[model samples]
Target: MKKLLIALLTAASLSACTTTESFVKGADVGWLPQMEASGYQFRNRDGKRQDALRILKDYGINTIRLRTWVNPSQDKGSGHNSRDETVAMAVRAQRMGMRIMIDFHYSDSWADPEKQVKPAAWRGHDFAQLQKDVYDYTYDVMRALQSAGVAPEWVQVGNETRTGMIYPEGHTDNWPQLAKLINQGYAAVKAVSPSSKVVLHLDRGNDNQWFRTWFDNAKANGAKWDVIGMSYYPYWLPGRPDYTASIDDLGRNLNDMAARYGSEVMVVEVGGEDDRPQNTYDMLVAVQAKVRAVPGGKGLGVIYWEPQGARSWSHYALSAWGADGRPTKAMDAFLRQP
Candidate 1:
């Protein structure tokens, strides 16, 4: 789907009715299939077990986020998030009338600010070869998704990459190399689907200074991206500030990023502990409101990260599903009318 602003401009003439754009109320349920495979079931409000996608849809979620890891099989117990598996998940999500956001880890496993392990195949390659590898891998993934009729609406070049992606070569300290890799991914996404918005993601939703430093260097080095994606986990973010302060800070930071980059922003990942369902619900409510209040409606969306994850491999604490298989109050936040 086209972005909010682009989709709203219907004609040059004034109309009595204004077309309101849809906000992306989304969920990063990348672990849903895997959790089901491990015998975890998700129950609807009626307590009846249902397909994960159906349950999310019933709760009013309009988008799904999936992460892709290259050569995941390079290590034992890896490969579950391989390109093929990601494509299958995207197909299912699209079939359910949900838009898709593909997040590229660009590694064999999780690639965060602290750890961005290089894919085994590209470890020994020189800088030029590494750039080509990134371009080819990204183009191939986009082509496969397109062929399967699951082309994504948004594509993230990397995940929670505050420092950068693909350790050493593409690390934040090496801004030129990092920007080249990011530009490669952006070009690949456009080559396959011009409508797909490319996102440059980073963690820390409240850190405006971090965003300025990172984005300044990226733009100076010619990085190409359309949207700014941020991960906001209140319980896990550094400092553990009060919820109200965190929400206010996030709003300020988002506005700054949108104004600076002239791009829309989204909380691509967000979660809070399930132990306090009410607290999580309140946080989500505030966050949704804050995002919508961004100047010029530049705030695009908010996505819950692994909201239905039960018995997660990582023992995640922020999932909204209780042990009884039913969703917690946190999921209801998405039901709020915009």
Candidate 2:
């Protein structure tokens, strides 16, 4: 009877241990709540920066990530945001106790794997000078933010730079120059504030090979980075290779990145909320679960690009309807986490 009791007690203790580990892993995993986690994705509409700020503060988000284009030439009959405009928003974020993360796109418009249209002013600059352009622009922005009392917590040298930022020049497959230019921006950011952490980002977290190829080259050339950031938009990543295999593959790959790079891995930008929030919300929750469940996965946290913007177009077209949308389902997803 005593042996039976002992066995039962041991089983109960093990069950309790399992429960404790599960709860802590989900709650205490490195979750950086940045307002711009995926907020605008390069387009800021209706001066919605203020609304962005309020939502973040309400949700305990301590970080704000903002992207900048070198000279995003008035695309589609719209004015591009300038350095001064970025600083202005950074100051507003500061007033509310949020740390800024500056993202340099290094182009006239967008800079990613799919698109990187060089600025018209930079058309004449050679590779050597192009590297300088990246460093100089990064330095100038940091200086302005410093003077304005809005120091950045982290600065991303470039966005979705799987192939490296700045095309035909700073582009990878030309690793010698590519890595050097990346280091130049890193140096520029360091020159101003050595304490600020530098983040190196890439898209398609599902592609371990993409990260491996880039980081392997970067390591060969000695890249400087504090955090490894990945962007995972559910609709986008699954189509990359094999959908059935890729989801689990991404979770494993992220764990591998943290160990391989020896850097804290941050999802940095992730989104859900399809044409409607129900399906996407569930997907986000499942991704969150996957991260927390995996033993080696440091899974920082999943961020919604623009949960509020899911139905934004309808509102702008008609002032009569007003905003009936709140991030009710999205918020519930995070809150419902087990």
Candidate 2 structure, TM-score to reference: 0.75
In order, the Cα lDDT scores of the candidates are 0.86, 0.64
Q: Which candidate number maximizes lDDT?
A: 1
lDDT of 2 at 103: 78
Stretches of candidate 2 above 4 Å error?
A: 1-50, 74-79, 238-245, 289-300, 314-323, 334-338
Question: lDDT tens string, model 2, 280-302?
Answer: 55665666665665455455554
Model 1 residue runs over 4 Å out of place are: 1-21, 74-79, 311-314
TM-scores for every candidate against the unseen true structure? 0.91, 0.75
Superposition TM-score, candidate 1 onto the true structure: 0.91
Backbone clash total, candidate 2? 1
lDDT of 1 by residue, 262-292 (tens): 9999999999888889999999999999899
Stretch of 10 with least lDDT, candidate 1: 12-21
Worst lDDT run of 10 residues, candidate 2, spans 24-33
Q: Extract clashing residue pairs from model 1.
A: none
